[model samples]
Target: MYDRFLVSKQIDQWLAEDIGGGDLTAQLMIDPRATATFAMNAREPMTLAGVEVAGLVFTRYEPACRIEIHAHDGATVERGALLMTVSGPAQALLTAERTALNVVQRLSGIATETAKYVRAIAGTKARLLDTRKTTPGLRMLEKHAASCGGALNHRLGLDSGVMLKDNHIAVCGSIMEAVKRARLRVPALTKIEVECDRLDQVEEALAAGADVIMLDNMSLETMRQAVALVDGRALLEASGGIRLDTIAAVAATGVDYISTSRPFQSAPAVDIGLDEA
Candidate 1:
């Protein structure tokens, strides 16, 4: 759902932020007609992502730039694999280098990290999920990378789905009232999920007819009970405190989905660099 219009707009913002008042360094050091080719390669294993958008960064400056994407998104690339090649104006290459590398490295890191979580829950009915914990303006791209790494997207934003969190419940005074109001306000196609931190809240949420029930940071015993309590009435999601070391047990507890913030919030950028080709 990330359209070119949006991507281009964001790219404009990035370029404006990074290249304000012209790239005087490039202006001083480079000739306008100087054309060169650059190759982007991985320094470590990664689930390839952002190649296309990274290409866009170059083209955004030099529209006629030649871009060859050797590795597409979701492809697993080994160390030293060539991800892409760009041949264009020397100034364009220099101007686009940092922004392009930052985007691809950050996104590839997320995709590669998410691959671990996906593999951990493989062969199970439980699906891996990503939360709203994403970079403010880059959620679209980041979520796309998560999907590339094999996790399904949850709510894209607050407007995309009806989710009643702890604060919403606290304000509404009870899960029943919060859900009832949301059910009346939203269309039938929209799913209403409630976040319950306690066992008693789980039953109350179930009774309120929420479409999905999230067990937030519950113990293994409590999660099992929550799944049984759900009993096919709603989709069960386990969130909070999920880690690579702990995700398998959480998945085994019969949660329909496992959500974590690590992929978006904590994944280190992959080491990929651009060099003259």
Candidate 2:
């Protein structure tokens, strides 16, 4: 769960979006004091996430509403499995359902996809990692779900680490120049990673004291050669064109980490449904 303030703010925005001026249907047809119980179910198999956020939605509308989650975060559930049961004012439940389910379903989808990648690389030296291609406001929640699914999160933001990409290299003119400039400008404790698209750049990065080198969009043969060239002087990472079917092969190349945006960006939203109990 995120901070209460953050959750509240998000909930407030969602409520405003949903209600607009008011829930005209609820006001027109439902009694103010009417209450009901509902069950949340998975319409398709998925990993669970955002349970607490869902509870927050219920709380925002009906402060006394009770939510009980039968399935835990990070737990895998089959289709039609009961995720949680909520009892609250009918209007509030109706208002909050979509927003709550939206968060859980999307995040669980990311977690589920990430879990597959993590499982694919099991027993390999390579670690599964997520890239910066995360949803704007939901980065924290998405990354949290990725961690739950057993993938290590890369830099949460640019401030967390110094990663010199191709554009940075182009602007600075060379990998070594970028690394040197970054080292001189940034703090001593800042870890530096340089993206190398070619095997020749690997030696330059290592020589320039790059702590980690990303082998972007390289073939397995090239990645293996890069790893061999690195020779443990710096941590090696393979990025780009990674898919579930291809991750194991990439991991087998002896790289320390494999990063991709697929788990967060391309994952289909896990199906979930709300049913009146």
Candidate 3:
């Protein structure tokens, strides 16, 4: 679970966005003291996430609200499966409904998409890894969902790892020069990875003592050859133009990791509905 205060803060923001100054429908239709019971059920099959986050919303709206979670985050659930039950003031329930469902649905969609990629490379040495192309302000939550779906997270931000991409190489003049400069300036604990688009760059990166080499947009034959050329000196990763249909073949190149941003950026929101019982 995340920090209670932080969760409460997020819930507050969501609630404020949903009910700007008032919830006219709930206030007009229900008694101030009236209470209700409701079960939150999945309208379609999905991986569960943000259960605690959702509960925080209801609890914040109505301090006396009681929430019971039947399905935990990271669990796969079927359509119509009961996820949670809540009892509280009718207005409170109505106020928190959309906010709660929004968090759960978005996070669950990330988890579900991550699960598909993780499953695609099952039984292979290559691990499914996510890139930094995460939703703004939701990176932490989305990465947590990815971990829940069994995918390893790459560098969370630029500061975590040193990756020399094409632009960096162009600015630095050559792969060898970039790797050399990075190696000289970087702390010993930091691992240096160089992105190589051609076999010559691959050789340059390997000769420059790069700890890892990324084969970017290389054909399968070239990737296999690059892997063989690197031997066991540096870790190999394949990136660019990866999809579900082509992941297995990419993994077969014997790369240690495969990175894609599609899972987080292209995932569809999972379907979930909140209703009063």
Best by TM-score: 1
Compared with the true structure, what per-residue lDDT tens digits does model 1 show for residues 1-277? 3677799989989888999999999989999899999999999999987889999988987797999999999999899999999998999899889999999999999999999999999988899999889999999999999999999999898899999999999999999999999998898799999999998999999999998999998999999999887898999999999999999999999999999989999899999999999
129-237: candidate 3 lDDT, tens digit per residue: 8888888867777777887777888888888989999999899998888988898889879999999889999999999999999999999999999989998899998
* lDDT (Cα, tens digit) per residue for candidate 2, span 63-106: 98899989988888899999899998888888788888888888
Clash-forming residue pairs, model 1: none
Evaluate model 3: give its TM-score.
Answer: 0.92
Output the TM-score of candidate 2.
0.94
Better of 1 and 3 by TM-score: 1
Best by lDDT: 1
Going through the candidates in the order shown, the clash numbers are: 0, 0, 1
Positional deviation of residue 53's Cα in model 2 after best superposition, in angstroms: 1.2
Task: List the candidates ranked by lDDT, beginning with the highest.
Answer: 1, 2, 3
Backbone steric clashes in candidate 1, count: 0
Report each candidate's C-alpha RMSD, comma-separated, in the order given.
Answer: 1.2, 1.6, 1.9
TM-score of each: 0.97, 0.94, 0.92
lDDT of 1 at 269: 97
Better of 1 and 2 by lDDT: 1
